[model samples]
Target: MPMKPAPDAPLCFHTLIHRLEKLKLNYLEIPAAVVQQLGGTFNIRLQCSVNGAEAFACGLVALGEGRGYITLSSKRMKPQGLQLGQQVAVRLWADTSEFGMEVPEELAELLRQDEEGDRRFRLLPPGKQRYIIYHVSGVKSSQKRLDRALLLINNLKQLPPGKEDFRAMLGLPPREAL
Candidate 1:
């Protein structure tokens, strides 16, 4: 069953952590009317103003029906000792998956360009693909991410399934090759 947001809407902005602490609400359902009320595909930054100071929250968006919900993990903000009617500012914008560590679209495109690339990659065990994706996305800098992604694609073209040259892909010398 789909969960529904309260009509009162908690002021459409803020809800106290203590009030929400024991609430094991997994998913917040936004009605279609609410989506129409707000423009489509918006970004929101959750902010907590506590003790006359404000702090930004690390949050994720969960899309459902026509509306989206900004979910704050407990780690980001503890929902304890929070006062009722506390202000939670939500700043909205378009969503961009590139803001965080994720598989590069360019890498996917590179794989798609080759006739057999997708097949070869798909044939590999899931673990291998996940390892490559993690390694490629783990780099902090954009240049490093791109470089690693290109190297991975090239290595995929050369190596057989189940056999990856991690050192070669990273431009590091292999023990034997060295």
Candidate 2:
């Protein structure tokens, strides 16, 4: 039987953080001590609540030696007036969302309608599935989202199991052909 989902107890932390000089990206570093306290591998998905606000899904990007950081986007920071080089309160919980990300309604409906496509998509690793979902949902137009969903699922169904390539899923020519 599948294991029961853990309770929603967030691991809280207050830390000083900084952004890269050349990039708009900001991140929170999880030290080896914190990693050990969390009792998991360096890389893991998390739902982060910043400054007691709403939670958002993110991943802990590993940096070796049991260290990792969660990237914070400008879109999420500007509204809250968050700045780098400031001490911030963060609460993190394991991300338990299906596919580790939100599935766009268009893709979810398409998958519901296409049994073979759904089967192929479900066979893909969670990260790969997130890639497709992100691509489909990135656009603002509903028609465009539907079009992308159809195109991606159609491309996904054509690839052999265990050999699905990201480029192929996007209907792009192989890198060598470029």
Candidate 3:
């Protein structure tokens, strides 16, 4: 069953898209009241719809001008054919999916076929699982997705020391401390 938000949750709203190019943050402004209730977490799992297309998004709510804003990504924008200045009908609730996004079939089959990979993959946190799923799902070609899935499984099988190490597995260098 889908996880429902708290009773009378202020999670439902219609907002206009606003842009923040300098910060690379394009988002809808969420009400401060909702932010307070949500504990001001930037990475809040949301099951939202853009226009009419159903989308699962990780909302980044940032505080500004004594209010709150929910950031949207280009990835979600592209698929939904969203554009700036369009009205976005967003109805958010707590994320209930095993992975924040849907697991691609190509990757799913790969994990099922490889026992070790399946074991290790399930060991990682749901966020990490979503990271791998999102990355592999970005490509168009099934061959590429399979190859990326294989690569991810191989590294995940190694069991990276931490999140930073997990990035290294994906050929990403350690992030510099801010």
TM-score of each: 0.38, 0.83, 0.71
Best candidate, TM-score-wise?
2
lDDT of each: 0.49, 0.82, 0.72
Best-to-worst ranking by lDDT: 2, 3, 1
Candidate 1 lDDT over residue span 22-131, tens digit each: 55543233334544444343343223233333443323344556655544444444553333344444332222333222456656676678657666666766446656
For 52-164, candidate 3 gives per-residue lDDT tens digits of 66655565556675466767878678877788878877776666666777788999999889998888888777677888898899899999999899888887776554542
| Candidate maximizing lDDT | 2
Off by over 4 Å in 1: 1-102, 171-173, 176-178
- lDDT by residue (1-178, candidate 2, tens digit) is 2232253777788866767557657888777666665665645677888899899878877756877788888888889898888788988877888777788899999999999999999999888888999899899999999999998999999988998998999899999999
When summed lDDT is taken over every stretch of 10 residues in candidate 3, the lowest stretch is 1-10
Q: Report the alpha-carbon TM-score of model 3 versus the true structure.
A: 0.71
RMSD vs true structure, all candidates: 10.9, 3.6, 4.9
Residue 55, candidate 1: C-alpha displacement in angstroms: 19
Clashing residue pairs in candidate 1 (N, C-alpha, C atoms within 3 angstroms): 17-79, 43-92, 43-93
